[model samples]
Target: MSSSHPTPQPWYKQFWPWFLIGLLLSSIAVSTSFAVLSIRSFDGMVQEDYYEHGKAINMVLAKQQQAADLNLGATLRIDPLTSDAVLDLTGDDRPERLVLKLIFPTEADRDHELRLEHVRDGRYLGQAPDNLRYRWYLQLQPDQETPTWRLVGEGRFPDEGEFALTPGRAADS
Candidate 1:
């Protein structure tokens, strides 16, 4: 018999499948590791109780007489200036009344509450009493205790950019 061995396969042909498999495995590993690390980092962050608190606050607002008569698609905005809180309310329809509250945590209790008064042109104004500290939230409650009275925005007074409320954060509140 002739002394001959089968021709060796070329490196490209022989190793391509293995190389592709390794690349895929490495990509999966890297992605999995990245996801795990990201989840861990997220878990370590502070969880704001805004959503629960906000729902509770909305429930309270809805119960008020004002919210009962409000028209559809109404919206409210709370603008905290250097010294005062201004509420601007607008919608496809006008609202009969607007209710506002300053919500904050106190030294003794976590729930500190302050009520505000309607100003004009669907605007409401409130002063932050000395007892209420900075970082207090201004909540605009229209039609005071009605299911229609939704939370428009809530955030600290004289807002620092960091404390500005976002849709996601507000929803969680």
Candidate 2:
């Protein structure tokens, strides 16, 4: 009897089929890698006590109003070389020790607070971060509770200049 032809091979064994499968797999691998990278680098900083903050909004506004009533303001200067922060107060009266809070917009760990010492009349001095840049929310207060005012501004380091901090009104927004 005549020899029978070999049975046709399955489609999976063919070169084109394997090549297409590999191409799809490679695309999936690339997309998955990008997704992982984005997740790891995301800076999603949210306040843990958002509810409390929301509840205390009225009090915060009241404090702002208090600052307005007192007509308090200041001029802030940071020396890049010495990392020294100076505040010149312009108001009716000054507190014994003014609290300077440098709050990072997105990173809570980068937030810093300095209890500025009153060097002279309407002048306060404290140590600031050496390498501070980008936008920052500044809160100048005497204590943790009431009598607080917020000043939002951007810090352009390595440049010798001064920034204004007026109470009851945000510098940037």
Candidate 3:
């Protein structure tokens, strides 16, 4: 007597084969996502002339030294209500125009420069844009010849406290 046997299903139809395929597909999906994200988000530093920039540091320091020699001091006040910035300067020479620089660290797009008007003797006033809330690197410079003096400081936006500016450095209130 001869016995008849049933044929087994193909590997493609089997559950274990499909499960293995699913795991491989999932791994590929995750790796592709990571690669896309890595390509999209990159640090913004792309300057190739890093050496030249480093060499220019000396010139910047020299300008600071000029400020130090001039005995420049300024008191900065920011109004919280209107966001208006006022600078009171004390030094030998009074500049006709003052250049105010507001630098937002890590965000170059937000950096601003305002030419302050001389309100009176030893007083400068400028209408800074309102609703600013961030840390800033403040640079107050006189509109003068090259190698002129400047005062540097750091402060939070909408600052109500008083800040004293020293040449090449910042002083806390």
Candidate 3 total steric clashes = 0
If scored against the real structure, what TM-score would every candidate get? 0.37, 0.78, 0.82
Cα error, residue 125 of model 2, in Å, equals: 0.8
Q: In model 3, which regions exceed 4 Å deviation?
A: 1-8, 46-48, 144-147
Query: Rank by lDDT, descending?
Result: 3, 2, 1
User: 168, model 2: CA deviation in Å?
Assistant: 2.7
Error of 3 at 155 (Å): 0.5
Top candidate by TM-score: 3
In terms of lDDT, the poorest run of 10 residues in model 3 is 142-151
Enumerate clash totals for all models, in the order shown.
14, 0, 0
- Find the 10 residues in a row with the least total lDDT in model 2: 149-158
Q: Model 1: residues >4 Å from true position, as ranges? A: 1-83, 93-96, 105-114, 131-134, 143-147, 158-173
Per-residue lDDT value at 109 in model 3: 79
